[model samples]
Target: MRKWGLTLLAVFLTIILTACNQNDSKDEDKKETSEKTSQKKEASQDESGEGFKALKEKELNSQRNKKTTNDSSDNQIIDYTDKQKIAMLLFQPGLDDKFITADDVLKGEYQSKFSDGVKKKHLPKLTVTSLPENTQMDNTPTGTKFYNIQPFPSQYSVNIAMNEHNMIIFGSQSPIPDYNELLHGLDGMAKVYKTKDVIKSEKDNPKLKEVEDKVDMQ
Candidate 1:
């Protein structure tokens, strides 16, 4: 009976040790799985942050490119700077017979100006102003007609008309911003026509000359 009791004690001790070893193995597996899951989550967050940064950079670059294209196109238009050149473009065609009409001047190409943060085309509105009865000439029996333009409220005024001698004259209240370029564009549309030589504005057409001088805008 004593030997049998010692054998049973030995078997019980073996069973307890085996159970403890199995529990320790399961705990180690659980720890390893937890560590792997944490590493995957951190890697996913890093990838999402990198993608968002790349998208933001792309949008900024596209906007910069669009602005550069607009600036380049604006530079392509002509710029004016001279007064005599502008006057010659508007001068009467006494000997050469180059004739420019009000419609041609109105349709001329122009540069743009910025107003209230928006780009506005520099186009002028043309209106025909009739002279007094005394200022009327044989060529213009009713009255001398002048084309005037004062497109912008802040800018100066300009007038163009034929005098009693049939000579074309150009006048302005003050210096125009880009008159040279504007007139040059108008010159491109001039038509050649035959009119008798009458350059008498300085010598004999005093009344019409005075009306021409008085032609201005408010």
Candidate 2:
């Protein structure tokens, strides 16, 4: 009887140990699953936050651009420290025959780039303002926001227009960030073109002459 009792005691001990081991394995699996789920949630939240931040930044840029457009005085500062070259092109009415490449200037390759950011349905015109003066809309006829200089891609133009029967183009080899400054320039140049004093005038600055010389040489 004593031997039988000892055997039963050993069997009971083995059963308890097996049960404990099984329960421990299940607990470990649950803990691991909980940790994995937590990590996934953290990663998801991080991605969502970053997406929101990017969207907000894009909105801010659009709003600031509009504000710059609405207020002519809010001129964009030029980063000339980077050595941006200022250039312009002017086409006179009677003095010169209409530019032979005028069609190319208004359509093809250049016009395609201007439509990049906008949808096909909302094809907005490229904004042009006189640099330094940003007076494109000042003292001009109503209902006209400077002449749409075509095919001359705004990405390349920096400032451009076909105002008062004159083609005025302005740019910097280095991009001007606050294009409104160039808008001011567009306004000033358009104002000057009205007088038809693009060349050989006391008001013609050195840079303006250089641009004129470039087109004449071309």
Candidate 3:
């Protein structure tokens, strides 16, 4: 009976040890799997360039705020309500680089050209405004004459393009403040499109002259 009891005790100890070892193996596997998942998640975020996108969004918000002159010196408000037009910063693929620059878009340096891709990529919010009664779409807008009115000299090169809808997309890195400095902004409140009919557009739409004047200066 004593020998039998001893054998049973040994068997019980062996069973407990085996169970503990199995549990430990499972825990190690789970830990390794969790680590790999974390690594993959980090890699995906880096590839998508979410950091730059987030920064660009923040900058846009800052630009869209109502124009104020009394703000702290740290920030220069860019919204110019007198212009009655939207003045906001745009981001290129890289958040650091502005889509438009002030230096590259010298007067007569570039001409208006219709690009469908430009519309989709830069100004997805662009809507088709009616052309003047006599004005028709210049299929080759590249040939159309675009007068460049200098708002001010810029520290960085300007980037600009035109869309099929006749809206001009201009970009500059300089921040034109809305209060006092907005008049000096590189591309302060430039209109996205222009009209051809002086009578049809201007005759019909009273704001045509105002829009054209603003575009000319920008």
Candidate 4:
């Protein structure tokens, strides 16, 4: 009877120990699963945030390109050949002055003042001849006299000329941020030609004397 009791007590203790170990293992597995879920949620949030940022950037760029395209189209339709004569004058008055250098002229304050002055003048028969260095005169009207007034100290100057029919288009440039604006301004000043006007002018003023004089000189 005593041996049987001891055997039963040892069996009960062994069963209790095994159950405790299995419970511990289940608890550990639950903890590992929860940790993995939390990490996945964090990674998903990060990816979503990055995607939103990329979308916003793409939208901004699209708007910018659209604006640029519209402006370019408007400039392209401008008529620069309508006028018989056109003149452009650009004066950077203090550009080469002792107190102001080319670098100083590029400042915002100076540019504003210069641009405002040109706009206010609004000369009908003048053109601003301060084109970019890379500008080519291939399409420019014949007999146009482009002068760099202050050729040495400043890159700005005036263009004066008569077109084939003696009609005049005067243009000027201010410190405009957009090149399209300047081109449009020039196009505005050019006069549209009519077939009748050309025929009438030629009939009224024949070039016989002019042709004879040129022939003699040659």
Instruction: Evaluate all candidate structures by whole-model CA lDDT and list the values in order.
Output: 0.41, 0.40, 0.37, 0.38
**Which portions of model 2 miss their true places by more than 4 Å?**
50-218
TM-score of each: 0.24, 0.27, 0.24, 0.26
| Residue lDDT tens for model 2, 1-218 | 99999999999999999999999999999999999999998878766888667888999999999887645322221211101111233323331222212222223212233446622222222222333333433343332222223224334433343332333444334443443444456333322243223322323344443332222110
Worst 10 residues of 1 by lDDT: 77-86
The sequence of per-residue lDDT tens digits that candidate 3 reaches over residues 13-43 is 9999999999999999999999999998987
- Which parts of model 3 are misplaced by more than 4 Å? 51-218
Can you give the lDDT of residue 180 in candidate 1? 35
TM-score of 3: 0.24
Cα distance off (Å), candidate 3, residue 16: 0.9
Q: Residue 166 in candidate 4 has what lDDT? A: 35
Candidate 2, poorest ten consecutive residues by summed lDDT: 77-86
Tens digits of per-residue lDDT for model 1 on 30-115? 99999999888877766688866787788999999999876653342112111211222233343122222222344442333224
